[model samples]
Target: MTLTALRRDAPSGKADWLVIFLHGYGSNGADLMTFADYWQGSMPNVAFVAPDGLHEAKDGGFRWIGKRPAGDPKLYDDAVEAAPDLHAFIDGELSRVGLDASRLALVGFSQGTVMALHLGLRREVAPAALLGYSGGLVGADRLSAEVTSKPPVMLVHGEQDQLAPLYGMMMSVKAMSEAGIVCQGVPLAGLGHAVNAEALIYGARFLLSAFAFREKHGV
Candidate 1:
Protein backbone atom coordinates (compact mmCIF):
# COMPACT_ATOMS: atom_id res chain seq x y z
CA MET A 1 0.00 0.00 0.00
CA THR A 2 1.19 3.50 -0.82
CA LEU A 3 1.33 5.73 2.24
CA THR A 4 0.75 9.43 1.68
CA ALA A 5 3.42 11.62 3.24
CA LEU A 6 4.72 15.18 3.31
CA ARG A 7 8.43 15.46 2.55
CA ARG A 8 11.00 18.15 3.11
CA ASP A 9 14.32 17.65 1.41
CA ALA A 10 17.57 18.59 3.03
CA PRO A 11 18.45 22.22 2.48
CA SER A 12 22.01 21.33 1.55
CA GLY A 13 20.75 19.15 -1.28
CA LYS A 14 22.62 16.28 0.35
CA ALA A 15 20.63 14.18 2.77
CA ASP A 16 22.91 13.13 5.60
CA TRP A 17 20.20 12.61 8.19
CA LEU A 18 16.54 11.62 7.91
CA VAL A 19 13.94 12.55 10.50
CA ILE A 20 10.44 11.14 10.23
CA PHE A 21 7.74 12.86 12.25
CA LEU A 22 4.57 11.00 13.23
CA HIS A 23 1.36 12.75 14.29
CA GLY A 24 -1.26 11.68 16.81
CA TYR A 25 -4.60 10.02 16.10
CA GLY A 26 -7.22 12.08 14.23
CA SER A 27 -4.46 14.05 12.55
CA ASN A 28 -2.62 13.86 9.24
CA GLY A 29 0.94 14.30 8.04
CA ALA A 30 0.41 17.94 7.21
CA ASP A 31 -0.24 18.69 10.86
CA LEU A 32 3.22 17.55 11.95
CA MET A 33 5.09 18.69 8.86
CA THR A 34 5.00 22.16 10.30
CA PHE A 35 7.86 21.14 12.55
CA ALA A 36 10.12 21.35 9.56
CA ASP A 37 9.36 25.05 9.31
CA TYR A 38 11.19 25.54 12.60
CA TRP A 39 13.65 22.64 12.59
CA GLN A 40 14.94 22.67 9.02
CA GLY A 41 16.94 25.86 9.35
CA SER A 42 18.74 24.37 12.35
CA MET A 43 19.52 21.07 10.68
CA PRO A 44 19.94 21.94 7.03
CA ASN A 45 21.38 18.56 6.10
CA VAL A 46 18.51 16.56 7.49
CA ALA A 47 15.42 15.56 5.48
CA PHE A 48 12.00 15.35 7.10
CA VAL A 49 8.94 13.23 6.34
CA ALA A 50 5.56 12.92 7.99
CA PRO A 51 3.03 10.32 6.92
CA ASP A 52 -0.73 10.23 7.42
CA GLY A 53 -2.18 7.50 9.57
CA LEU A 54 -3.48 4.29 8.08
CA HIS A 55 -7.09 4.45 9.15
CA GLU A 56 -9.84 7.05 9.31
CA ALA A 57 -11.39 8.29 12.53
CA LYS A 58 -15.11 8.82 13.06
CA ASP A 59 -14.67 12.57 12.85
CA GLY A 60 -13.13 12.16 9.37
CA GLY A 61 -9.54 12.49 10.44
CA PHE A 62 -6.69 10.05 9.88
CA ARG A 63 -5.60 7.74 12.71
CA TRP A 64 -3.38 4.80 13.37
CA ILE A 65 -6.34 2.74 14.49
CA GLY A 66 -10.08 2.66 15.01
CA LYS A 67 -11.73 5.25 17.27
CA ARG A 68 -11.51 4.12 20.88
CA PRO A 69 -10.72 5.49 24.29
CA ALA A 70 -7.05 5.70 25.18
CA GLY A 71 -7.27 3.23 28.05
CA ASP A 72 -9.15 0.63 26.05
CA PRO A 73 -7.44 -2.78 26.12
CA LYS A 74 -7.91 -3.11 22.37
CA LEU A 75 -5.76 -0.08 21.64
CA TYR A 76 -2.65 -2.22 21.69
CA ASP A 77 -4.30 -4.65 19.33
CA ASP A 78 -5.14 -1.76 17.02
CA ALA A 79 -1.52 -0.74 16.95
CA VAL A 80 -0.44 -4.30 16.21
CA GLU A 81 -2.86 -4.37 13.32
CA ALA A 82 -1.52 -1.11 11.88
CA ALA A 83 2.17 -1.93 12.35
CA PRO A 84 2.97 -3.75 9.11
CA ASP A 85 1.98 -0.96 6.77
CA LEU A 86 3.82 1.67 8.77
CA HIS A 87 6.87 -0.53 9.04
CA ALA A 88 6.92 -0.89 5.30
CA PHE A 89 6.48 2.83 4.78
CA ILE A 90 9.41 3.61 7.04
CA ASP A 91 11.69 1.16 5.31
CA GLY A 92 10.76 2.19 1.80
CA GLU A 93 11.04 5.86 2.56
CA LEU A 94 14.49 5.43 4.08
CA SER A 95 15.72 3.53 1.05
CA ARG A 96 14.26 6.05 -1.31
CA VAL A 97 15.96 8.87 0.53
CA GLY A 98 19.32 7.04 0.30
CA LEU A 99 19.79 6.92 4.06
CA ASP A 100 20.33 4.09 6.51
CA ALA A 101 18.90 3.36 9.93
CA SER A 102 21.94 4.80 11.68
CA ARG A 103 21.28 8.13 10.00
CA LEU A 104 17.58 8.06 10.92
CA ALA A 105 15.51 9.46 13.77
CA LEU A 106 11.85 8.96 14.61
CA VAL A 107 9.86 11.75 16.28
CA GLY A 108 6.31 10.95 17.25
CA PHE A 109 3.38 12.58 19.05
CA SER A 110 0.56 11.00 21.07
CA GLN A 111 -0.57 7.85 19.24
CA GLY A 112 2.33 8.40 16.91
CA THR A 113 4.58 7.88 19.94
CA VAL A 114 3.20 4.40 20.39
CA MET A 115 4.15 3.56 16.79
CA ALA A 116 7.66 4.95 17.15
CA LEU A 117 8.30 2.94 20.31
CA HIS A 118 6.78 -0.25 18.99
CA LEU A 119 8.46 -0.34 15.56
CA GLY A 120 11.69 1.43 16.45
CA LEU A 121 12.44 -1.13 19.19
CA ARG A 122 11.69 -4.15 17.03
CA ARG A 123 13.38 -2.89 13.88
CA GLU A 124 16.20 -5.07 12.59
CA VAL A 125 18.57 -2.13 12.96
CA ALA A 126 18.31 0.63 15.52
CA PRO A 127 17.68 4.27 14.62
CA ALA A 128 20.14 7.04 15.47
CA ALA A 129 17.68 8.38 18.05
CA LEU A 130 14.01 8.25 19.01
CA LEU A 131 12.00 11.21 20.33
CA GLY A 132 8.40 11.00 21.45
CA TYR A 133 5.97 13.65 22.67
CA SER A 134 2.72 13.20 24.62
CA GLY A 135 2.80 9.43 24.32
CA GLY A 136 3.78 6.18 26.08
CA LEU A 137 4.93 2.69 25.27
CA VAL A 138 2.13 0.51 24.03
CA GLY A 139 3.51 -3.02 24.53
CA ALA A 140 5.79 -2.58 27.50
CA ASP A 141 5.10 -6.12 28.68
CA ARG A 142 6.42 -7.70 25.48
CA LEU A 143 9.39 -5.40 25.03
CA SER A 144 11.85 -7.69 26.79
CA ALA A 145 11.24 -10.49 24.35
CA GLU A 146 10.48 -8.47 21.24
CA VAL A 147 12.92 -5.59 21.34
CA THR A 148 15.65 -6.06 18.73
CA SER A 149 17.48 -2.78 19.18
CA LYS A 150 17.95 -0.06 21.79
CA PRO A 151 18.56 3.39 20.41
CA PRO A 152 18.61 6.40 22.69
CA VAL A 153 15.09 7.68 23.44
CA MET A 154 13.66 10.97 24.68
CA LEU A 155 10.04 11.09 25.89
CA VAL A 156 8.36 14.41 26.70
CA HIS A 157 4.89 14.65 28.16
CA GLY A 158 2.71 17.16 29.97
CA GLU A 159 2.46 16.72 33.73
CA GLN A 160 -1.21 17.66 33.50
CA ASP A 161 -2.00 15.48 30.50
CA GLN A 162 -4.96 13.23 31.21
CA LEU A 163 -5.12 11.61 27.79
CA ALA A 164 -1.64 10.14 28.09
CA PRO A 165 -0.56 10.70 31.62
CA LEU A 166 2.91 11.66 32.77
CA TYR A 167 2.98 8.57 34.95
CA GLY A 168 2.82 6.35 31.91
CA MET A 169 5.94 8.06 30.56
CA MET A 170 7.61 7.62 33.93
CA MET A 171 6.89 3.90 33.88
CA SER A 172 8.14 3.68 30.30
CA VAL A 173 11.37 5.37 31.31
CA LYS A 174 11.85 2.78 34.02
CA ALA A 175 11.20 -0.04 31.60
CA MET A 176 13.65 1.37 29.08
CA SER A 177 16.27 1.91 31.77
CA GLU A 178 15.95 -1.68 32.98
CA ALA A 179 16.41 -2.82 29.40
CA GLY A 180 19.73 -0.89 29.22
CA ILE A 181 18.47 1.73 26.77
CA VAL A 182 19.26 5.41 27.33
CA CYS A 183 15.93 7.07 28.12
CA GLN A 184 15.09 10.66 29.03
CA GLY A 185 11.62 11.62 30.21
CA VAL A 186 10.73 15.30 30.55
CA PRO A 187 7.38 16.21 32.04
CA LEU A 188 6.29 19.80 31.54
CA ALA A 189 4.42 21.47 34.41
CA GLY A 190 0.92 22.90 33.91
CA LEU A 191 0.83 21.56 30.36
CA GLY A 192 -2.15 19.62 29.22
CA HIS A 193 -2.67 17.00 26.46
CA ALA A 194 -0.88 19.12 23.90
CA VAL A 195 2.59 20.03 22.75
CA ASN A 196 3.93 23.27 24.10
CA ALA A 197 6.76 25.49 22.90
CA GLU A 198 9.02 24.13 25.60
CA ALA A 199 8.58 20.57 24.43
CA LEU A 200 9.30 21.47 20.79
CA ILE A 201 12.44 23.38 21.72
CA TYR A 202 13.58 20.55 23.97
CA GLY A 203 13.09 18.05 21.16
CA ALA A 204 15.15 20.21 18.81
CA ARG A 205 18.02 20.38 21.28
CA PHE A 206 17.90 16.64 21.84
CA LEU A 207 18.06 15.90 18.13
CA LEU A 208 20.89 18.35 17.66
CA SER A 209 22.90 16.75 20.45
CA ALA A 210 22.19 13.26 19.15
CA PHE A 211 23.28 14.00 15.61
CA ALA A 212 26.30 15.96 16.77
CA PHE A 213 27.37 13.04 18.92
CA ARG A 214 27.00 10.73 15.96
CA GLU A 215 29.17 12.97 13.78
CA LYS A 216 31.91 13.32 16.40
CA HIS A 217 32.17 9.58 16.94
CA GLY A 218 31.37 8.59 13.34
CA VAL A 219 28.75 6.20 14.73
Candidate 2:
Protein backbone atom coordinates (compact mmCIF):
# COMPACT_ATOMS: atom_id res chain seq x y z
CA MET A 1 0.00 0.00 0.00
CA THR A 2 3.00 2.29 0.31
CA LEU A 3 3.18 3.58 -3.24
CA THR A 4 5.41 6.34 -4.60
CA ALA A 5 3.71 9.57 -5.64
CA LEU A 6 4.13 13.02 -7.15
CA ARG A 7 2.80 16.04 -5.29
CA ARG A 8 2.14 19.73 -5.91
CA ASP A 9 1.75 21.68 -2.70
CA ALA A 10 -0.78 24.46 -2.44
CA PRO A 11 0.42 27.98 -3.18
CA SER A 12 -0.50 28.98 0.37
CA GLY A 13 1.66 26.16 1.71
CA LYS A 14 -1.42 24.98 3.56
CA ALA A 15 -4.08 23.12 1.70
CA ASP A 16 -7.77 23.29 2.61
CA TRP A 17 -8.65 20.71 -0.05
CA LEU A 18 -6.91 17.75 -1.62
CA VAL A 19 -7.25 16.24 -5.09
CA ILE A 20 -5.89 12.75 -5.76
CA PHE A 21 -5.35 11.91 -9.39
CA LEU A 22 -5.41 8.29 -10.62
CA HIS A 23 -3.98 7.69 -14.05
CA GLY A 24 -4.94 5.14 -16.70
CA TYR A 25 -3.22 1.87 -17.59
CA GLY A 26 0.48 2.05 -18.45
CA SER A 27 0.58 5.65 -17.20
CA ASN A 28 2.32 7.10 -14.19
CA GLY A 29 1.02 9.44 -11.50
CA ALA A 30 3.04 12.30 -12.97
CA ASP A 31 1.00 12.04 -16.13
CA LEU A 32 -2.21 13.00 -14.36
CA MET A 33 -0.67 15.53 -11.97
CA THR A 34 -0.48 18.01 -14.87
CA PHE A 35 -4.07 18.83 -13.95
CA ALA A 36 -2.76 20.57 -10.88
CA ASP A 37 -0.87 23.03 -13.05
CA TYR A 38 -3.99 23.96 -14.98
CA TRP A 39 -6.08 24.55 -11.85
CA GLN A 40 -3.50 25.86 -9.38
CA GLY A 41 -4.26 29.53 -10.03
CA SER A 42 -7.97 28.93 -9.61
CA MET A 43 -7.64 26.84 -6.50
CA PRO A 44 -4.75 28.22 -4.49
CA ASN A 45 -5.86 26.35 -1.38
CA VAL A 46 -5.82 22.92 -2.94
CA ALA A 47 -3.01 20.36 -2.89
CA PHE A 48 -2.66 17.69 -5.57
CA VAL A 49 -1.10 14.23 -5.40
CA ALA A 50 -0.92 11.44 -7.94
CA PRO A 51 0.19 7.95 -6.92
CA ASP A 52 1.83 5.45 -9.20
CA GLY A 53 -0.14 2.29 -9.81
CA LEU A 54 0.42 -0.86 -7.74
CA HIS A 55 2.50 -2.54 -10.47
CA GLU A 56 4.66 -1.35 -13.32
CA ALA A 57 3.50 -1.91 -16.90
CA LYS A 58 5.50 -3.87 -19.44
CA ASP A 59 5.99 -0.96 -21.85
CA GLY A 60 6.73 1.67 -19.20
CA GLY A 61 4.64 3.61 -16.57
CA PHE A 62 2.23 1.65 -14.27
CA ARG A 63 -0.97 -0.39 -14.22
CA TRP A 64 -3.71 -1.06 -11.66
CA ILE A 65 -4.99 -4.50 -12.83
CA GLY A 66 -1.74 -6.47 -13.39
CA LYS A 67 -0.92 -8.04 -16.73
CA ARG A 68 -4.06 -9.06 -18.58
CA PRO A 69 -4.74 -9.35 -22.27
CA ALA A 70 -6.92 -6.64 -23.84
CA GLY A 71 -10.31 -8.35 -23.48
CA ASP A 72 -9.77 -10.25 -20.28
CA PRO A 73 -12.57 -10.26 -17.70
CA LYS A 74 -10.01 -10.81 -14.97
CA LEU A 75 -8.87 -7.24 -15.54
CA TYR A 76 -12.16 -5.97 -14.10
CA ASP A 77 -12.16 -8.46 -11.24
CA ASP A 78 -8.66 -7.54 -10.20
CA ALA A 79 -9.39 -3.83 -10.34
CA VAL A 80 -11.71 -4.50 -7.39
CA GLU A 81 -8.98 -6.66 -5.94
CA ALA A 82 -6.62 -3.69 -6.17
CA ALA A 83 -8.88 -1.42 -4.08
CA PRO A 84 -7.46 -2.01 -0.61
CA ASP A 85 -3.98 -0.85 -1.56
CA LEU A 86 -5.25 2.28 -3.25
CA HIS A 87 -7.54 2.90 -0.29
CA ALA A 88 -4.58 2.53 2.04
CA PHE A 89 -2.62 5.13 0.10
CA ILE A 90 -5.60 7.45 0.15
CA ASP A 91 -6.19 7.15 3.85
CA GLY A 92 -2.53 7.50 4.64
CA GLU A 93 -2.09 10.58 2.45
CA LEU A 94 -5.19 12.26 3.87
CA SER A 95 -3.80 11.82 7.38
CA ARG A 96 -0.31 12.92 6.38
CA VAL A 97 -1.74 16.10 4.83
CA GLY A 98 -4.09 16.71 7.82
CA LEU A 99 -7.27 16.52 5.78
CA ASP A 100 -10.18 14.17 6.43
CA ALA A 101 -12.34 12.31 3.96
CA SER A 102 -14.72 15.25 3.54
CA ARG A 103 -11.98 17.39 2.01
CA LEU A 104 -10.70 14.72 -0.36
CA ALA A 105 -11.55 14.58 -4.05
CA LEU A 106 -10.75 11.65 -6.29
CA VAL A 107 -9.99 12.29 -9.97
CA GLY A 108 -9.48 9.19 -12.06
CA PHE A 109 -8.92 8.27 -15.69
CA SER A 110 -9.52 4.96 -17.52
CA GLN A 111 -8.64 1.99 -15.28
CA GLY A 112 -8.11 4.41 -12.45
CA THR A 113 -11.68 5.62 -12.78
CA VAL A 114 -12.98 2.16 -12.12
CA MET A 115 -11.01 1.99 -8.90
CA ALA A 116 -12.18 5.42 -7.81
CA LEU A 117 -15.81 4.45 -8.09
CA HIS A 118 -15.33 1.12 -6.37
CA LEU A 119 -13.27 2.50 -3.52
CA GLY A 120 -15.07 5.82 -3.05
CA LEU A 121 -18.47 4.23 -2.83
CA ARG A 122 -17.31 1.71 -0.26
CA ARG A 123 -15.55 4.17 2.04
CA GLU A 124 -17.07 4.59 5.50
CA VAL A 125 -16.51 8.33 5.33
CA ALA A 126 -17.47 9.37 1.84
CA PRO A 127 -15.12 11.45 -0.26
CA ALA A 128 -16.22 15.01 -1.07
CA ALA A 129 -16.51 14.14 -4.74
CA LEU A 130 -15.70 11.43 -7.24
CA LEU A 131 -14.74 12.44 -10.78
CA GLY A 132 -14.00 9.75 -13.33
CA TYR A 133 -12.84 10.09 -16.91
CA SER A 134 -12.90 7.57 -19.78
CA GLY A 135 -13.86 4.53 -17.67
CA GLY A 136 -16.94 2.61 -16.71
CA LEU A 137 -18.09 1.24 -13.39
CA VAL A 138 -16.70 -2.13 -12.39
CA GLY A 139 -18.87 -4.45 -10.28
CA ALA A 140 -21.85 -2.15 -10.74
CA ASP A 141 -24.32 -4.91 -9.93
CA ARG A 142 -22.61 -5.33 -6.59
CA LEU A 143 -22.74 -1.60 -5.83
CA SER A 144 -26.24 -1.60 -4.38
CA ALA A 145 -25.16 -4.19 -1.87
CA GLU A 146 -21.72 -2.85 -1.06
CA VAL A 147 -21.95 0.94 -1.31
CA THR A 148 -21.63 2.68 2.03
CA SER A 149 -21.82 6.27 0.81
CA LYS A 150 -23.17 8.21 -2.11
CA PRO A 151 -20.86 11.10 -2.84
CA PRO A 152 -21.53 13.42 -5.74
CA VAL A 153 -20.00 12.05 -8.93
CA MET A 154 -18.96 13.40 -12.32
CA LEU A 155 -18.23 11.19 -15.30
CA VAL A 156 -16.60 12.71 -18.36
CA HIS A 157 -15.93 10.84 -21.56
CA GLY A 158 -15.02 11.50 -25.16
CA GLU A 159 -17.62 10.83 -27.83
CA GLN A 160 -15.06 9.28 -30.14
CA ASP A 161 -13.23 7.27 -27.52
CA GLN A 162 -13.04 3.69 -28.69
CA LEU A 163 -11.11 2.41 -25.70
CA ALA A 164 -13.77 3.19 -23.13
CA PRO A 165 -16.68 4.56 -25.05
CA LEU A 166 -19.27 7.16 -24.11
CA TYR A 167 -21.98 4.56 -23.62
CA GLY A 168 -19.89 3.00 -20.90
CA MET A 169 -19.74 6.36 -19.14
CA MET A 170 -23.50 6.70 -19.44
CA MET A 171 -23.96 3.23 -18.06
CA SER A 172 -21.90 4.26 -15.05
CA VAL A 173 -24.15 7.29 -14.68
CA LYS A 174 -27.19 5.11 -14.85
CA ALA A 175 -25.84 2.77 -12.22
CA MET A 176 -24.90 5.56 -9.82
CA SER A 177 -28.16 7.42 -10.32
CA GLU A 178 -30.23 4.34 -9.67
CA ALA A 179 -28.39 3.98 -6.42
CA GLY A 180 -29.51 7.50 -5.44
CA ILE A 181 -26.18 9.19 -6.00
CA VAL A 182 -26.08 12.56 -7.72
CA CYS A 183 -24.20 11.94 -10.93
CA GLN A 184 -23.40 14.04 -13.98
CA GLY A 185 -22.24 12.88 -17.36
CA VAL A 186 -20.41 15.12 -19.82
CA PRO A 187 -19.45 14.15 -23.32
CA LEU A 188 -16.82 16.04 -25.28
CA ALA A 189 -17.87 16.47 -28.89
CA GLY A 190 -14.81 15.18 -30.69
CA LEU A 191 -12.26 14.20 -28.10
CA GLY A 192 -10.54 10.87 -28.50
CA HIS A 193 -9.31 8.70 -25.64
CA ALA A 194 -7.67 11.59 -23.84
CA VAL A 195 -8.23 14.54 -21.57
CA ASN A 196 -8.16 18.00 -23.10
CA ALA A 197 -8.30 21.64 -21.94
CA GLU A 198 -12.06 21.51 -21.63
CA ALA A 199 -11.94 18.46 -19.38
CA LEU A 200 -9.44 20.18 -17.10
CA ILE A 201 -11.60 23.28 -16.78
CA TYR A 202 -14.71 21.28 -16.11
CA GLY A 203 -12.87 19.24 -13.51
CA ALA A 204 -11.47 22.34 -11.80
CA ARG A 205 -14.85 24.02 -11.53
CA PHE A 206 -16.46 20.78 -10.39
CA LEU A 207 -13.98 20.33 -7.55
CA LEU A 208 -14.51 23.91 -6.40
CA SER A 209 -18.26 23.47 -6.45
CA ALA A 210 -18.09 20.16 -4.62
CA PHE A 211 -16.16 21.67 -1.72
CA ALA A 212 -18.49 24.66 -1.68
CA PHE A 213 -21.52 22.39 -1.52
CA ARG A 214 -19.98 20.39 1.30
CA GLU A 215 -19.43 23.62 3.24
CA LYS A 216 -22.89 24.98 2.55
CA HIS A 217 -24.77 21.80 3.36
CA GLY A 218 -22.34 20.61 6.00
CA VAL A 219 -22.90 17.02 4.88
Tens-digit lDDT track of model 2 for 122-173: 8888889999888868767777888898899998899999888788888889
In model 2, which regions exceed 4 Å deviation? Answer: 66-73
List TM-score per model, in order: 0.95, 0.95
Across 1-219, the per-residue lDDT of candidate 1 in tens digits comes to: 788899999999999899998899889999888888888889989999999888777787688865556556687788888889988998888999998878889999999898888888878888888999998787677778888898889999999998888888998899888888899999899998888779889999999998988778754
The pairs that clash in candidate 1 are: none
lDDT of 1 at 95: 99
**Residue ranges of candidate 1 with Cα displaced over 4 Å:** none
